[model samples]
Target: MEFKGAMGGIYRLTEWITRLAATNLLWVLCSSPFMFCLILKLLVMNQNLANESLQMNWAMAILAPLTLFPATSAMFTVVRKWVMGDTDTGVFRTFFKGYKENYKQSLIGGIFYTLLFVIMYVDYTVYMTQLSNLQIVGVIMLILIIILLVSMFNFFSMVAHYHMSIGQIMKNAVLLTLIRPFRVFSTMLGSAVVIFIGVKYPVLFLFFIGSVVAWFAFFNFYGTFLKMQDQMEKMKQKDEEQESVEDKKSDNLQK
Candidate 1:
């Protein structure tokens, strides 16, 4: 028993470490837009290349969706497979396969969400100077931003798991995110802490940040979805039973 327990613990540790390394490495390679522009900025920002730096920043910002869409979709796929105990699909292969498979949908999703966030930011900036009803617009925009980001966690998960249309995905994402508020809060908190750690200790960005945050967030989402599925099944069974009971009662009344 002691040996079996030790082996299990070690296996889990090794599995986690292996996944973290693989996920973060894939994340780095896939985030070329941000990394390349960051490197360019770092090299030129202090060299009096202000105009070029600005252009690089603009390119990075504009490329954000294109860069992140496929990668995030792929990451979510890899995470799902890992969590599902499907050891058959190799991590890198799974990520690339998902990236290719979901490329079009992810690109569209990325564009939509990116535009939504950008619009929110722009509107917030425009309204910051005003002290009128625009404040209400600003507040609404802020709320939308929160909802968008919160739903984003579930959106990627859903995209990985479902073959729904973009509109369907969006609607379900919003609903699922709202269905489990505590899950969203935990994911947000985990993400914030990850960002703080990455900023404070840049070395972690290379190996730990992305995978660690994603794994924890994915855990919460996976549990929420499973619980929801069970609850829905229960409700469905209850409805069926109630319908059967009503049918029987009607039959007796007719008799």
Candidate 2:
């Protein structure tokens, strides 16, 4: 029996808050090593230790493929259920289940993305600073980096939603980013807003940033996927209708 009063509203609001907070907390906990390294890098930067900061950056890059990527994919999985209207799904059970199931693909994806990002960033720096005449190349690299960043968001969503190989997922993620500019920009804007707020209010990072962003990103990605499916269905129906017309004409001619 559903309660019909302010009490019900309050109960739902509290439950929703708890779900987001708990999921975010679990993500942070599972990816603690990466977080620790990030924090260390920030501290080093504040101290103006350029060499130590660079070391921390490498450490984060290495540790991220192992910890952050898988954990993030798992978080996306949890949020995917909620987006698909399974609000009562158990957060802990769903999160770890996603992590275990998607670990290999996520790890492979993480390594590839990490390496690509590092190489592009280094190239971007070199072209901009060392080879000043090739600034256009640096701009192109920057664009690719942005595209990659947005595609990475879609990567997590695809991991949660699709049962494709890593290669297929990566190909589609990049294709979707390039072809669906509206969706790509919308997801990027939403995530950037959430991240900006999360950064400004550090406390939110502990309980909302990661999970909320994952939910929003996956929500947008799923919307794009549904639209594509609808288009494919329409095309298939058109083909069948054309074939039916041809078959009827041939039968009439034969008669």
Candidate 3:
């Protein structure tokens, strides 16, 4: 039975909180090994075990493509449903369904992104540190790195929402990031806020951060996707009108 008045408002709010927390928990569980390595890396850093810290970093990198990326894509899938008004869907069923469908693509894309980040970071470090005269080059690299990070956000959103090949998704994600500056910055800003909150309240990661960020990212992505679709439709209609005008001209000439 549905509650009336304030009870209904509380019920709805509680329900959404439950959904977000549950999905975030599932994400953490799925990516547990990577998270473990990440935490261990932090501990190692605290102890000043430089060698072990480096080793843990490598371990995390290896596990990221295998676990974190697929889990994150699945999380994005769940949040995409919520953003698209399918809030009543089964969390477990939707999450795993997205995992199974998106695993290979997410893994491949993850590898590409991981390698790209490593290379760019190295370049940024060298230019900014060892080659002081090329600090300007490092600044450009830093900007590119940020763009890639934002593009990765778009990548997950696209992966969860679009049924395209990974190549096409990557191409479109980068294009969208570059072409739609406002949305790109909006996503980045929202994500930064989420990250900041999560860092402040580390416990939030256990229950809210991942899913919350995924929801906001896809919410932004879907809005942009709809606008792009509308623009494409208008362009197609304009082309059809032009074709019709040309046909009329041809008929007039034949007469």
Candidate 4:
């Protein structure tokens, strides 16, 4: 009996370790596609920072949205499954499936996002340099820009969780931002804190930065999605109840 109990404990221990290792491994794998493009974007943006070539900077900016969107889409796909207690699906299978399914829409979104960033950056620069009179306008633009960015934090995650068209997805994200502003701010703040810590300790970024951030982002998003879902359900129930009451009143009159 002693030997059997010992064997059972060992089996459980090994299983736990194996599950952890497998999860991290999938995260690492998902982060690969984004890594290369990230490096490219960094290099390009950093080039000639002192006396930057405008066209070259904007030209290379294209790589980021194109690459990051697809990879992010895939990563969230795996993250969504894992969070929802459905980790049995092959991680690779789910990752690539999301990448393929969300590719076109994500690309469009990527371009849209990148273009918005570039436009904002350019406007900021212009206002600072040449368009001084528009500084007030620039400040308003800055607020809009920040909201767009905060909204983006949950954009891909929503794509994983729902089946809206890209345009609708974008609109819904904006609505989500309006509805759950606090959650949106909290996610961005948490992400910034993690990223700052990772920056201070480069080793963290080396192995787990991408996955760690992704896991938390998905976790945060899952919470927000649940709240939104619950609210929607409540609204639906209320509508149904209202309709039923109205129907009963009509029936009484008919009788």
Instruction: Please give the CA lDDT of all the candidate structures.
Output: 0.82, 0.94, 0.93, 0.75
Model 1, which residues run further than 4 Å from truth? 1-8, 38-57, 130-133
lDDT of each residue in 1-255, candidate 2, tens digit only? 455777899999999999999999999998999999999999999999999999999999999989999999999999999999999999999999999999999999999999999999999999999999999999999999999999998899999999999999999899999999788889889888998998899999999999989998998888988999999999999999999999999999999
The TM-score leader among the candidates is 2
Model 4 agreement with the true structure over 73-133: per-residue lDDT tens digits: 7777877887788856776678779888988888888888888888987787787678888
Best candidate, lDDT-wise?
A: 2
Q: How accurate is candidate 1 locally (lDDT)?
A: 0.82
What CA RMSD would candidate 2 show? Answer: 1.5
- Estimate, for each residue in 150-192, the C-alpha lDDT of model 3 and write its tens digit: 9988999999988999999988888889999798789889988
The RMSD (Cα, Å) of candidate 1 is 2.9
**Superior candidate under TM-score, 2 versus 4:** 2
Q: What's every prediction's RMSD, in angstroms? A: 2.9, 1.5, 1.8, 4.1
Give candidate 3 misplaced runs (Cα > 4 Å): 1-3
* Residue pairs of candidate 3 with colliding backbone atoms: none
How many residue pairs clash in all the candidates, one count each? Answer: 0, 0, 0, 0
Provide the lowest-lDDT 10-residue window in model 4: 48-57
Cα TM-score of candidate 3: 0.94
